[model samples]
Target: MASSSSSSSLKFTVRRCQPQLVPPAIPTPREVKPLSDIDDQEALRTHLPVIQIYRKQASMAEKDPVQVIRQALSQTLVFYYPFAGRLREGPHRKLMVDCTGEGVMFIEADADVTLDQFGDSLQPPFPCFHELLYDVPGTQEITNAPLLLVQVTRLKCGGFILAIRLNHTMCDGPGFKQFMSAWAEMARGATKPSIAPVWRRELLMARDPPRITCNHREFEQVQDTLPSSDQNLVQRSFFFGPLDIAALRRLIPQHLQHCTTFDLITACLWRCRTKALQIEADEDVRMMCIVNGRGRFNPPLPVGYYGNAFAYPAAVTTAGKLCRNPFGYAVELINKVKGEMTEEYLQSVADLMVMKGRCLFTTARSYMVSHLARLNLKEVDFGWGDAVYGGGAKAGAGRFLGVSYFCSAKNGKGEEGIIFPICLPAEAMERFAQEFNLMLGNKSQPQTSSATFIMSTL
Candidate 1:
């Protein structure tokens, strides 16, 4: 009897190897199928072009800057030869172009910079993803599709700012980081990379050619219909010390019955965002959390899967109810949404991609802006030292603001907080900051009620 009991207990423990969580089933408009007659080989032959321009150091003059840049572009193309074959798809398998072809000009400004100055510096950011590709005359149709743009600005103080505008389709934060590392290696003149680029498509390929699964149909949404203007948006950086984050983590298990640190933090932000916006309970408020699908799949993603390896898993709550709920309750909602991030769900999405074929482009255009926030930026460091400050998605883009938090390695600050670029109405921005500070225990003293909120500049 004792031996039997022990055997039963061991089996039970093995079954719980990371609780089985699956995404909630959402209904899809229709079932789509891949084109039977299309040539798959021809489809995969395209490349994601890259453009870059380097500013020569002062005291060094080039008679023909354009000629010099042309040469540099040719050399960079050779350096990118290995990666040329990888970026052939639209977004996930999509290519990335180096967009520094036009000579990058330098601007001298005061030590103190304003938001407008920064914005001005990145004028006419890459219009589309294809534009980042090489400037081929007839291939202009393909190369001019500018999805990502990068600007490496040399400051008068001897520092450089590498600003990149990435199309959401290419890759999420992690994918971008991988590409950057590769680019850096090329820039440093390394014959071979410390980290070899992985481009094994078969490993990422779906089980069989027509692997049609019902789950794939539900998550498909058109991306282009997303709102384009977020002019009223505002961005602010917040710091949560190690002790504070640890305290929150400890309190989480007690408050939210079942959840992780990521869920709790997201819930806290979602609640605060709705409260500050004065959104009503009946209206749906969503928090889109990005899930990295690299190692999550069953067979696992290839090392060189450079395309978009991130998916948006969303949780929604009404404004009134969210504000009234405890932080833990919100955390549970996040957990529920995260639970759905399974290998089946990711493969379902891939299967959908294969089926939709041409229609996929139209679908991507419609559902782009659904109030999503990504949390993995904290892990992005170019080795120039962990990013002291990092953020993207310029203000005035969407109703749902995206905030990315980075982990601070310096000073052992365990998972340092995020730098949020919020797109809220002007009036709501002030209140959002107040609630944000309150979460961090930085509220004003009882003696000064007026001091509870302080407005921040863009």
Candidate 2:
């Protein structure tokens, strides 16, 4: 794509807007410590970086979105004030919020561009991804940090993009959506939040004497080194219409037909990603699927608990076997691990980390995918009409070989489907696209032998 095409660097001017602090009367909780497993001992890593794109509110075109959102955010922060706090570097990579209500970084920018410039593509590296998101100033190393940053960019045609850059550890998808929902409701004049925010992480803390109940590979204490991926990366978006996703489901065995929308799509992506990279036969390839810890918790955490309740349960296998196996093999592997994300599994994870004593995540020969379909982004109205299009912006900010997020979108013909913003090495991306298309194109021919189908595409 058009995303990386040097079609004139996206031009924009940013006049740093006034910083917004937590409402004066809002109460701030005392600072909390990081989980004992601090990869901080090894590297200064920040939370998973994320951004969401929202089109301008047509009816409120003449209204001051900045003023509206700022005021609303301030009010919303009264209930979710921790987001206004700043992160303090503890030991290297580990961080704890100061909870002093320092406030979030806010910016206002203008571009001599129109939403049309993006031409239906929402992958990042588009003109605004850089201008609309903020990276902390100073050593440019992980030392400088902020809890949240919001950018409102006004386009020339009276349209605007609401870009949000926030730390992942502050909340999971539901928690973040709750915060945004509260802000939106406040902007629309809600006297109170729809859901009260809660912070009871201690309830789910590791048990004394650390009970171990799961045999997960993650529960072991081998102290394995994290994997590393290539530094040269590019992002692109792929759309799978309702029909395309259904076709993928049909590719698997009949008994496995109940595969989830995420499972079906990710299996395709994992295979294509592997083929694109052309890893050696003996090399190991891994896919880390994010699992929600909220449901897995015993007596599940409060529906309103605003904290990190996500886990990356991985599925690993050699590249040779991955490419050679039937499509059902990958489907079974993905579903199997996803099924293991239970309360027991989480307890074992807490206990294992307490014993091994380190936060370990890898960046090499790996791919991580998350589907935000539950965010129901299209239904998220903020006085402005529902977003023309909105989802995660693919910022290549971390060491992961590939980072992908999926969300619902209306294809060109207005058919319902999902848009996946994917980031991978440039060359790998080309192979990825070809493989993805080939797989979809083969759905009409269901009888093709699995080996024949995979090899012919390769």
The candidate 1 region of ten consecutive residues with least summed lDDT is 1-10
TM-score of 2: 0.84
- Which stretches of candidate 2 lie above 4 Å from their native place? 1-58, 89-95, 136-144, 218-231, 395-397, 442-458
Q: What lDDT is reached at residue 158 by model 2?
A: 66
At residue 216, give the lDDT of candidate 2. 52
RMSD after Cα superposition, model 1: 17.7
Model 1, 229: alpha-carbon shift in Å? 9.4
Which candidate leads in lDDT?
A: 2
The backbone clash count of each candidate, in order, is: 44, 3
Error of 2 at 155 (Å): 2.0
Stretches > 4 Å off in candidate 1:
1-143, 146-148, 200-231, 255-260, 353-387, 390-417, 443-458
- Please give the CA lDDT of all the candidate structures: 0.40, 0.64
Worst 10 residues of 2 by lDDT: 449-458
